[model samples]
Target: MMRPHRGLDPGSVWAQRLRQLEQRLRTKEERIVVLETENALLHLKLAEYQGLAGRSTNEVLQLYAAHGQQMKLQRSSAVTQLHGAIKRLKQDLKSLRSFALELSKDFQRQSKTCLYQVLAAVQGIQLQNEAMQMFQIKAFDLEQCLQEVTERYEKEKQKRKALHNNLIELRGNIRVHCRIRPLLPFDDSAGHSVSQDRRRNFSEKVAYAADDETVLVKCSRPGHASVNKTFQFERVYNDLESQDAVFADVAPLLTSLLDGYNVCIMAYGQTGSGKTYTMLGPQFDGNLAFSIEEESELGIIPRATQEVFRLISEKPPGSYWVEVSVVEVYNNEIFDLLAKDSYGKVFGIKRDVVTTREGKSDVPLLTHETVENASEFLHLVNKGLQLRVTHPTLVHAHSSRSHLVVTLTITTVVFGDNFGTSWEDEQTSQRLNKEASCTFPQKMRDSKSTSSSRASSPVQLEATEKMKQVKTRLQLVDLAGSECVGMSGVTGAALRETSFINRSLSALADVLGAIAEQRSHVPYRNSKLTHLLQDSVGGDAKLLVMLCISPGQKYLTESLQSLGFGTRARQVQRGQVKKKTFPVPSKGK
Candidate 1:
């Protein structure tokens, strides 16, 4: 009733408008509540995502820290090991450097001694003053005097004679020979440029020659053939047949030495020749391919063993034995190739002890032992090869940096007094009728005979006593290749090595020259190599020299020099005496 009368009441109309405003306000409140609820839900979801993201970030940081720690630990450990290895390597280098220095000093000393000795040979130079006599007249007189001295020296020495006499199969002795061949084209070929293509072609030719030689060696039997008897048989070598032949001819003698005689076989050559191939061979391609363990590839040492066994097989057991000693001369120093001491250092051979009259004690003093077969000898030979030092050069692919010496010692013993005497053991007692009454030193030493009858049995007793201690030594030497300084392209250490090599070779040449001219004072102690080879050259051991030559034209000069050395070597004369003792075997006894 009041609303119907609102036209008259202003307060009633205002109240109605207020009620309409209240209804609209209620709608807006509802909208605001909905929006607040949605905002609260969104805030809760954001809080949950933030918590997960914070956890993930913490985990990643922890992982990075662990990884960094691990990397740091690894780096520390690697540094430790590297330091240790470097320290060890540095020590080894230091030792090697010291050794090199010592060798250099020794070489210089030897050179000085050689120079003095050579100068001593011409003593008359000091006698004539430069102003007193004509230089030409003095020279002529000196030359004439030298010639007279030479003639007298040649005529005076009947005691020392080179025993090249090969033992006949029945005599049980050894023979030594030298075989020289024509030069090769690549022997002296050197330089880095491709212009040295000729070397390649020659190498191919050598390879072809090696193949052919292999065929020849393969055709022969192990013990019966010469090829199998001498070479290393490891590799088929090109143009080494002459060496093989030399070995074959010496097999019987080597057997005798093993049976109780001393023998020495050496291969001498300039770089690029077949010395290595002749001695070492390629790798079991020749006679080595054919046989069993006992008779496998008759290399020089193996063949010698077989021959020794053959001789021993015919002899009474326990009557004969053999041993070997191996050594190397590196830059004039002696290194025991067969020594088991890994910590040992190589030492120089003293010049005083290594003289011609007094051999080197450091050259490996061999002890006597018993060897049963060829396999044992091969084992020792292989050991020596392992101990030898080899390097590569422009002249030689596998150049021997040292002088390798393999000495075999043979000892014979008669344990029982009841040994049967036959024609083989009987002494030929031919007496000198002219000197029948003279008492020789041998006769004086024999107590079995009376002083009155001592002269009658002198020859037989001396021969018998000589036969009692039938000991022999065999030497197999592989000398480092001699190379020219210019051709070798040497520098620094290499240069020093070349100089040493040249000086040593020159000393050797001087010694040979003295021997060829029959000089009274032969400078055998001038170089370590000569001193070490005293027994082989001037002592009891038989000497066999193989002068290897390169067929290449480039090597003509070296080849000629090698041949000249061979000629001089052949002219050298030596004495015959029984070996003092048996060489110790490289293998552990």
Candidate 2:
């Protein structure tokens, strides 16, 4: 027995306490029932006595009331009995309350222990729920990030797809043609004498003489015969057939203008060359001549107009009307030839700065007119040319002191098989496409028109909304000839003219040089001529440079320089033409 003694087990100890609490609870219940029974007996006797006093019989009832009153006095004993029972009940209730207090203390201790255990379990469950929620939130955030990445990738793919579809190339076969001027009555020997006389006076003759040298002139067309001669250069290209051949290669492009493609044709050469004659036929009217009757008379401008008309005629009548804007870049200024303004003043140049599909700003919009035929177009162009300032130099007569730009703005509408509606109003149709005319800075219009001519007339230029519809510019440029300052012996105002001419021509050369070397920055903004031709030379315009040469050995150096310019121009590759579709206005503002 003394070997080992086990401490009280937790389970047995709890069971013993529960049993003791149950015994005390039973005794309190029995005592409460006894006290309640005694109180009820005393209350019943008091009620009986009161009822006897309220009876209906007079004397007998009064006596019965006195008897009831005595019984009531005797009933006072019930109060003593009630007090004794209450005292006993109070004693039992005190014992029961003491026991209950002890039991409550034990219950409190057990409850505290149970609550701690429950709190620990609940805490573990809450931690698990929080971790699950955090994981779900992280998963949702990752899903959203993946979706955004996919959307960005899709947008980039669409941009690439659009770029892939807009690629275009020069689609025609390349051909080279030369136009020969007709022979003049002045023999080669006579021309040489006159050259010698001019040279002796100026003392500015070239080292090589025109003794055995000959000029080969050919028509621009396929079947025309070449004229070979050992004479002056100007006399060689004087024929109509020869001039026609010069513009033959560009006929297809001119036709496309009427078909809604902006086309530009430019000529570049030295002074005294056949550029003017080639572009504008030397004013000739041989309607009575039998040889001219069967043949198509071609001057570059006239032929171009005819071609435009031909293409437009293939469609319905009045379907296409060409608007022309003839402007000149004189010295370093822009002059609207068709403008009725003062000599030194001209209309401002405006262009819509648009972003092409390639995200480039090479496209420009120009303002122009709707011309009916070649004759009407020529009238406008001639008016502009007449307004231009020309001067005579010792080397050449009526030398163009500035660059001439002729913009043929062609607009074609597809009518709904109703010619009446088409011709009724030009503003009715929605603008489908827009072509830019030559984009020059408006500031260039401030330059003087001539050394002596004053700004007399005010510009009465009328603008058409149709001009805003042109997105592509068809620029035909005839640049002023580069001259040797020393040889020209220019002085006074002529000196200023010579300087401007040199500087501008030099700038043009620089641009060509930079472009030839693939320089990122070409100085097109340096000169007005360059700025006006910005579209044709560097923008999305297709350019053609015709280097007119004098085969005379006397002009060999100048001719070589002109050829060098053409070679440089050929190296420039301005991506491709970006065609823009004009959105139909809800209501034009």
Which lDDT tens digits does candidate 2 get at residues 1-589? Answer: 0111256443344445555555655665565556555555544544553353234234344554778866555445554564566566557656655665676676667556655545554565578578979999999999999899999888986676335323322421111122322322221222233576544322322222132122332212236763333222111222344554456556756644543445567776766666776676565331213257333444577667667667666654433445566666665766655443366344444232333464333214333444566666666566667666667765566777777888765543332232223422444432222211122123323321221111111111123233322233466676777777654545788767767877887888788777667687888878877766665566555455555665444454565566556555655555555343342221223
- Which run of 10 residues does model 2 get worst, by summed lDDT? 451-460
Task: Name the top TM-score candidate.
Answer: 1
Candidate 2 Cα errors over 4 Å, as ranges: 1-241, 284-298, 341-367, 414-472, 580-589
lDDT of 1 at 330: 70
How far out, in Å, is residue 234 in model 1?
A: 27
Measured with C-alpha atoms, the lDDT of residue 173 in candidate 1 is 26
Against the true structure, candidate 2 reaches a TM-score of: 0.49
Q: Each model's C-alpha lDDT?
A: 0.52, 0.52
Model 1 C-alpha lDDT per residue in residues 1-589, reported as the tens digit of each score: 1221433443444356555645655655565566556556555655564565465456545654777766556555654664565566556556655655665566566556544543443332344344346777888899999999988876653222222142211222222233333444434355666365655543322211333112121122225742311222112334545434545656756554643446777777887676665565544222333445423324465455566677767654444455656677777666655554346433222222233223433332332223456566666566567667766777776677777777665544421232223212523112221122232344323322121112112222232332332445677777788888777676787677666666777777787687667688877778877777765565565566766666554554575577567666755554444534432221121
